[model samples]
Target chain A: DQQVKQNSPSLSVQEGRISILNCDYTNSMFDYFLWYKKYPAEGPTFLISISSIKDKNEDGRFTVFLNKSAKHLSLHIVPSQPGDSAVYFCAAIMTGGSEKLVFGKGTKLTVNP
Target chain B: GAGVSQSPRYKVAKRGQDVALRCDPISGHVSLFWYQQALGQGPEFLTYFQNEAQLDKSGLPSDRFFAERPEGSVSTLKIQRTQQEDSAVYLCASSLGQGGWGLRTEAFFGQGTRLTVV
Candidate 1:
C-alpha cells in the first residue's frame, strides 16, 4: 500500500499565478514532511519542510500547508516562474526509529511564459 | 565544499551481469543513503548507512543488492545479477548527523548513476 500519495501527475500554471500541488498520507505516525524538486538527469533537491507541530511553512515564493485532520498537504508557489518547471516530490518520515522517508510518485509542474 | 559525487554517470549492463556503482559522499557526512528512481517516478528508498554501519537494509529489493561503506567514507552499491527491472537511476545522498536527527537533517544528493540493464 502507498502510505504517501500525490494525486496529481502534472500541473500547468501561467507565469505570475499560483501553482498548487497536493499530497496525502494514510499513516498517522508520520510527523515530518518535506518537498523536493528534481530537474532532468539530476537528483531531487530539498526545497522546504515542516514538522507536524507546525501547520504551515513559507520560504520566499514557496509555501507548504499541512492539515493533520485531513491527512493532506499542499505546496503553493506564487508568481510561478519558468525556472520552477520540474518534478516535485512529497515525502514523509516517521521520526522515532530508523527514520526512512516515504515518497509519493511525484508531480510535474510546468510554468508557461 | 564538494557535494556528493558518483562515478560512471551512466551505465549499461547485460541481463545477467553483475555491476557495481560508486558514491563519494560529502566530506565527513555520517549518514549515507541509496535510492532508485524509475522513469516518471519518484526515488524509492533502497538502503541506508550510518558511518560504516549498515543500519537499514530492509528497503533493498533482494539479496542480490549489496551496499557497503567501509572505513566510514566512500561507499559502493553492487548488484549481484543485473535484471532488466533494475534499469533506473540510482541516487546517493548524505546528511550530517546521527540516526536520531538524520531524518530531519537535509540530505545532499549526488547526480546519480543511470543504469540500463539490457
Candidate 2:
C-alpha cells in the first residue's frame, strides 16, 4: 500500500505565477516531511523539509506547510519561474528508528514563459 | 563536496541473469539506503545501513535481493536470477547521521542505476 500519496499527476503555470503541490499520508507515525525537485536524468535535490514540531517551514521562494491532524502537507512556490519546471516529490519520514522515508508518486510541474 | 554516486547508470540483462548495482556515498556519511522506483511510480524503500551494519532490510521484495556494505564507504546491491519484475531504477541515498535528521539534515540521492531485466 502507498502510505504517501500525491493526488495530482501534473500541473502547469505561467512564469511569475504561483505553483502549489500537495501531498497526503495515511500513516500517523510519520513525524517529518520533505520535498524534493528532480530533473530528467538527474537525482532528486532536496528542496525543503519540516519537523512535526512546526506547522510551516520556508526557504526563500519555497514554503512547506504541514497539518498534523490532516496528515497532509503542501509546497508552495510564489512567482514561479521557467527554471522551476520539473517533477516534485513529497516524502514523509518516520523519524528515529529506521528513518525510512516514504515518497509520493510525484507531480510534474511545467512553468511556461 | 561530492554527492552520492551510483554506477552502471543503465544495465540491460536477460530475465534469468544476475545483476549487481553499486553506490558510492558521500565521504564521512554514516547512513546509506537503497530504494527502487518503478516506471511512473514513486520510490519504495529496499534497505538501510548504518556504517557496516544493516539496520533494516524489511523492504526487500524477496530473498534474491542481497545488499552489502563491507567497508562502510560503498555498497552493492545484487539480485540473483533476476526476473522481468525486477526491472526498475535502483536509488541510493546517504545522510550524515545514522537516521535522517530531517529538519537539520536531508538525505542526498544519487542519479540511480537503471536496471532493465528482459
- What does chain B score (TM) in every candidate? 0.93, 0.96
Q: Candidate 2 on A1-113: residue-level lDDT in tens?
A: 88999999999999999999999999988888889899988888888899888999999999999999998999999989999999999998877656678899999999999
Lowest lDDT sum, 10 consecutive residues, model 1 chain A, at: A93-102
TM-score of 2: 0.97
C-alpha lDDT (0 to 100) for residue A20 of candidate 2: 95
lDDT of each: 0.90, 0.91
TM-score of chain A of 1: 0.98
**Model 1 C-alpha lDDT versus the unseen true structure:** 0.90
The 10-residue segment with the lowest total lDDT in model 2 chain B: B97-106
> Which candidate ranks first by DockQ, i.e. highest?
2
Residue-wise lDDT of candidate 2 within B1-118, one digit each (tens)?
4899999999999988989999999999989999999999888999999999998999999999999999998999999999999999999999987676465566789999999988
